[model samples]
Target: MQRMLDGLIKFRQEDFEEHKALFSKLKRRQEPHTLFIACSDSRVMPEMITKSLPGELFVVRNIANIVPPYKEVHQDYVATTSAIEYAVKSLKVENIVVCGHSNCGGCASIYLPDEVLNNLPDTKKWLELAQNVKKRVMVHLEDETDEYQREWLTEQINILEQIKHLLTYPYIKEKYLNKELNIYGFYYMIETGEVFIFNYDTGVFELSN
Candidate 1:
């Protein structure tokens, strides 16, 4: 906490002062180009990963970076749906990137014991949205190596699933079909610092370099 506070102090004294004009303009309003959604994991820093500066990306971070299929029951769609609608309809972001990373603890949590999952009921339930993702990957790649490759495959599949879920939103569907917004699925490998983009044409993830 002290570190963060001190960093803010330094920003106010130095960085913010140096970029006063930029900050002054940003203080008025923001028009970001992309809506970047990723995990709340400490290791996943979207700005650093994408080499973006302040005000460049509008971001939403949640455990597993999951976006539930739009629903109104019990107002379950409150947070995720609101963010999606605002980003698309109001913010008017041109691109929406659903990024999933390697070695996601949320993905591995499914293998946890009952006791563990019982304590994380909400997380467990949210992750259940990816049940089809887990089933599809496990069955399709049963013969694949059980190492980084498999983990990467799972992460890639999760990103694809989230992208599909994004389109399920009525507003997103309309915008996407009208070519008003573009959706992308990205897999970021933490260890290797590589980003693989899911190619809609070939239905495969290829390193974006």
Candidate 2:
């Protein structure tokens, strides 16, 4: 608590003052350019990683960075979907990034047995959105035994899945098809500070260097 308080003090005294003009401009309204959907993991700092300033990225973080399909958006309390909708339909963000990071506990949790998952109750239900992620990854996992590689592959595939989910929205799909909006799938390596971007045409996650 004290550490957070000290950080807040510094932000108000130093960082905020340095960007006071920008903050004043953003005080009334914000017009961020991108909608950044990413994991709720503490290590994945969207602003810091992208070197983005305030009013630059509208961010939504959730477990596994899951995006429920458009058909299910009608369901009650769909926070993630609602954020995506507002960003596209209201904010009119030009780019959407679904980012997943290395060693994500949420992605790994989906591989647990039903009993284990059920123990988590709400988490289990939320992760079921990614059940097919397990099935899709299992096919190519028969011969691979390295835990590290397996982890990254799952995280990368999870990013891809969420990107697909974003397109399920009619507005997003229409804008995407018309080339008015751009959606990206990003997989970050936390330890090495590396990022791989998904290539829609090549069907690969190429390094962002």
Candidate 3:
């Protein structure tokens, strides 16, 4: 806690002071260009990775970066869904990136038994959003036995699934069809600091040049 406080003080004294004009303008309003959905993992810093400024990306960090399918019936996902709606409809963000990372606990949790997540009811329920990814892996990658390989595949699949889920929103779909919105699936490899982008034309995640 002291470390964070000290950093805050340093930021106020140094970085904030240096960028006072930018911060001052941002104080009144913000117009971010992209909606970045990424994992809540401390290891994955979307801004740091992308070298994005504060007002450049509107970020939404959650467990596994999951984006549930759009539904007419509202449930407990108001926070996530509302952020997406506001980012798209209000902020007019042109790009939406669903970024999933390697070594994601949320993705790994899908392979664990129900008992393991029994005490974490909310987490268990929230992770149900990634069930389709797990099922896809099971049916497609059934012959693969390596644990790390499986997890990596799950993470990539989850990103694609979340992108699909994002399109379920009417406004997003309309904007996307009209070429007003671009959706992207990203996978970050923690060990190597490499980012891969899902290429729609090739149907593969290729390393970003």
Candidate 4:
């Protein structure tokens, strides 16, 4: 806590002061260009990675960067959907990027035994959103014995799955079909610091130049 407080003090004295004009303008209103959906991992810093300013990107982070499918009657409160609705309908963001990272605990938890997730009932239920990821991976990549390869593939597949779910929203679909909004899937390699972007034409994720 002290470390965070000290960082806050430094931010106020140095970072904030240096970007005072930008922050001042942002203080009144924000018009971010992109909606960045990323993982709740502390190591994944969306702003730092994209070098975006305070008001440039509206972000929503959740476990495994999952985006649940659009449904008229949601059984429970969903912060992700609310943020997506606001970003697309109200904010009118031009782009949406669903980013999944390497070595995601949420992705790994999908393969764990029911007993393992028994204590974390909510998390278990939440991760059910990515169950399709597991099903596809098991059927397609059954020969992949390498732990790292399996996890990496699952992370990338999860991003694609989330993107599909994102399109389930009518507003997003309308904008997307009209070519007014762009949707992208990103996979970040934490160890290598490389980003792979999904290519619709090739149906594969290639290294971002």
Candidate 5:
């Protein structure tokens, strides 16, 4: 808490004064160009990774960066879906980027012991939304080695799966079909500070060289 407060003090004294005009303009209203959905991982800073300034990207972060499919169950209007609807339909964001990162505890939790899994009830339920990814990746790669490479590959596949979940919303589907909004899937290699974007045409996540 002291560290965060000290950083705010620095921002107020140095950064804020330098970018006074930028902050002033933002006070009127924000017109961010993209809705950035990413994991709540400390290493994955969306603004730092994208080189975006303030007011450029509206962001929402959640465990595993999962997007639950639209459903009408009781008390179903959750934070993730509500944010998605507002960003796409109301805010009229031009693009939506769902980004996942390496060394994600949420993804790894799936392989954890029962005692550990039982401790994270909320995370467990949220992760089930991406259960299809686990099934597909496991079955298709049954003989494949369970090395670090496989985990990274599965993580990228999960990003695409969540992207599919995003499109399940009616408003998003309509805008996507009309080509009004572009959706992207991204993976961040935290260890190497590299980012890979999923190329829909090639059906692969290629390094953003």
Candidate 6:
């Protein structure tokens, strides 16, 4: 807590002061270009990773970076969906990036035994949205015992799955079909500090260099 407080003071004294003009303008309104959806992992810092300034990327971070199918979204848990709706309909963000990172606990939690997942009731329920993702990953891992490969495949597949969920939204689908919106699946490697983009054409993740 002290670290955070000290950081706040430092920001006010240094960073914020240095960007006073930019902050002054953003104080009134924001015009972000992208809606960046990422996992609630401490290592996955969306703004720092993208080098985007304040008011540039409206970010949504949730366990697994999951987006429920439009019709399946529940009234009790509408945080992610509401953010998506507002960003698309009201904010009119031109781009939406669903970022999945390496060593994702939410992705791995999909394979957890029922007994273990029982303690994490909400997390378990949230992760159910990606159960199909586990099946897809398992099929690809046939006869392979490499956990690292399994991890890599799962993370990338999760990103693609979230992208699919995004399209399930009527407005997003309309904008996407009309070429008014662009959606991207990003896989970020924490160890390598590298990003891989899911190539819609190639149907595989490609290094974003």
Q: Give the TM-scores of the predictions, in the order they appear.
A: 0.91, 0.96, 0.97, 0.97, 0.94, 0.97
Q: What are the per-residue Cα lDDT tens digits for candidate 3 across 28-61? A: 7999999999999999999999998779999999
Residue-by-residue lDDT tens digits, candidate 1, 138-180: 8778666575656766777788889988987888889899999
| Per-residue accuracy of model 4 over 1-209 as CA lDDT, tens digit each | 99999999999999999999999998879999999999999989999888898999999999999999999878789799999999998998999999999889999999989999998999999999989999988877867677777887899899999999988998899999999999999898888999999999999999999
| Candidate closer to the true structure by TM-score (higher is better), 1 or 6 | 6
lDDT, candidate 2, 109-202, per-residue tens: 9878988887899999899899888777887675567777677778888888888887888999999999999999998889999889999899
Error of 1 at 14 (Å): 3.1
Which candidate model has the greater TM-score, 2 or 6? Answer: 6
**lDDT of each residue in 143-180, candidate 5, tens digit only:** 56665765776788789989998888888889899999
CA-RMSD of model 1: 1.9
| TM-score pick, better of 2 and 5 | 2
Off by over 4 Å in 1: 72-74, 144-147
Stretches > 4 Å off in candidate 4: none
Provide the lDDT at 11 for model 3. Answer: 97
Model 2 TM-score, 2 decimals: 0.96
**Model 5 ranges with Cα > 4 A deviation:** 72-74, 142-145
lDDT by residue (114-172, candidate 6, tens digit) is 99999999999888899989999989896567888888898888898889999999999
Estimate candidate 2's RMSD in Å. Answer: 1.2
How close is each model in CA RMSD to the real structure?
1.9, 1.2, 1.1, 1.0, 1.6, 1.2
| Location of the lowest summed lDDT over 10 successive residues in candidate 3 | 140-149
Cα RMSD of predicted structure 3:
1.1
**What's model 2's overall lDDT?**
0.90
- Pairs of residues clashing in candidate 6: none
Collision pairs in model 4: none
lDDT of 6 at 9: 100
Against the true structure, candidate 6 has what lDDT? 0.92
